[model samples]
Target: MSRLRPEAGILPPVSSPIAQQASFGERLRALRQARKMTLQQASKETGVAQSTLSKMENNQLSPTFNLMQKLALGLGIDMPQLFAPVHEARISGRRSVTKKQQGREHLTATYEHELLATELDSKRMVPFKSRVRARHLDEFGGWVRHEGEELLLVLEGDVLVYTEEYEPLPLSEGDSTYFDSTMGHAVVSVSKDDALVLWVCVAQ
Candidate 1:
């Protein structure tokens, strides 16, 4: 990871107050409305059931990380955009700074994610810090697959990376790997303590 100098005026602090205040249901509805998409349409696009989408939009249901990923991909938006407001204008020299442990959090059964640079829309890459909480492959509902490429760097403890096409690989702190995002994959902590990792995914 490259360190940015705080004194550099080129980097601006990014905050998502709207995301922090609104429920996922509200945000989802807003996005759908903005795009003039119906729940049935969203269901078809996301591969999620219409009843599930309706329940989610009504705050009667909460989506898992995998489901959220599907939603983001179907909506043609980044995962962070599902939580924050979208800015459509294109700008040059854009940069954001997220202080330690200050990124927007998105929790799941197997991983706790701190989504970084979330205030910026139309990002080419999505960066986050995550804690591996699952201890076994069975903890995940299924393998996670999505568009683009991914890079994972272990920050603390140990983890086992499992992919559809390869044997599980163990990684320790400071170890990193890059792989195609389209391949189904999941990660679990192998250490007593949950492992932490920096994950960056290229937007496809």
Candidate 2:
């Protein structure tokens, strides 16, 4: 199991169905090789360091959502394609049940993402149960804007949502907000400890 840096915290051991079958690094490597591209080429195109790309391919690093999105764009594919294992066809009417502590994990500087519903490909939305880590806006290097819409439902503690067009908004447990993903936004924990949220974003 790969992990992020110390400040970002360690990723939970994955118990998700997807992780049991394949790894993010393995899939990423396969995609890279399939296009006859080298790590240097990918790094140049994606603006990600070659060492980081190598670590990701070697399963020594866990990529952030933004990093994964950049890799997808560099590979000339959509984000969903990165999660899909080659030669595995999409199963229609797919149903999945992810128990607590049982989803594929990806740790980032700001949040820990547990990706859910990986069994189905060509999905319109991707859901994650995330743990907010960063306590201040300065912790995030910049705004995060992506294609689609996103909904965040706070499950624990307090969180502050910062948007490009609006002032910082505070949310408590059981509060939820839906916003355009294209808008620059970031969420930070305001609680004394950690905060949890169920985030669902539509596919680009």
Candidate 3:
């Protein structure tokens, strides 16, 4: 899919005092509609109940990691797609902090990320919770871009994501964005507070 161009005058990064207002549930619904699939079709494919799917789409249910896998597989997407970033109203900086409980393995010193699903290694979709401290550019220095597109949901603070084509995508709480890492990109938190984000890197 092609990317939408960033709007003029970088949007001031979003700042939110409250968390859990993100559209995680709405994104799932958007994907389902975009694919022209019905709830029954997905439920049948995943062997899950139709009512369960409804609750999920309605944002009434918080899905477990295992259940997330089933939904992603049924939708012909990798597990990370469920939380993939969506282009938002262009904004420069956004702020919101979220503390997540993730798997221990994917956590890095500079960036603490919980692995949503191990299938990322093979499925080419790696989902992680990224926590970046201020002035922590070099912390991500160890990162090596392998392949795929990266999506981020800014949980808190400001992240300056630099790529080749355009300037950094500064995202904040409730904001989301996507980028291809082939051109070499890095995420830096310019905010005084810690920058927390959810990243889904997909290699297609």
lDDT of each: 0.79, 0.76, 0.58
Higher-scoring candidate on TM-score, 2 or 3: 2
Residue-level lDDT of model 3, residues 88-181, one tens digit each, is 3445453333344634222233454465653232345566777775354444433334345778888888778766577667776878888765
TM-score of 3: 0.45
Name the regions of candidate 2 deviating beyond 4 angstroms: 1-23, 40-55, 58-62, 73-87
lDDT of 2 at 154: 99
lDDT of 2 at 177: 95
> Considering every candidate listed, which one attains the maximal lDDT?
1
TM-score for each of the candidates: 0.83, 0.75, 0.45
Cand. 2 Cα-lDDT: 0.76
Give candidates' CA RMSD values in order.
Answer: 9.9, 5.9, 15.4
What's the distance in Å from true for residue 204, model 3? Answer: 1.6
Error of 1 at 152 (Å): 0.6
Q: How would you encode candidate 1's per-residue C-alpha lDDT over 1-204 as one tens digit per residue?
A: 122211100111123442345577788988888889889898898998898888777765656555777898889887889877887877899989999988877666678778899899878888999989999987776677767899999999999998877889999999999999877788999999999999998856
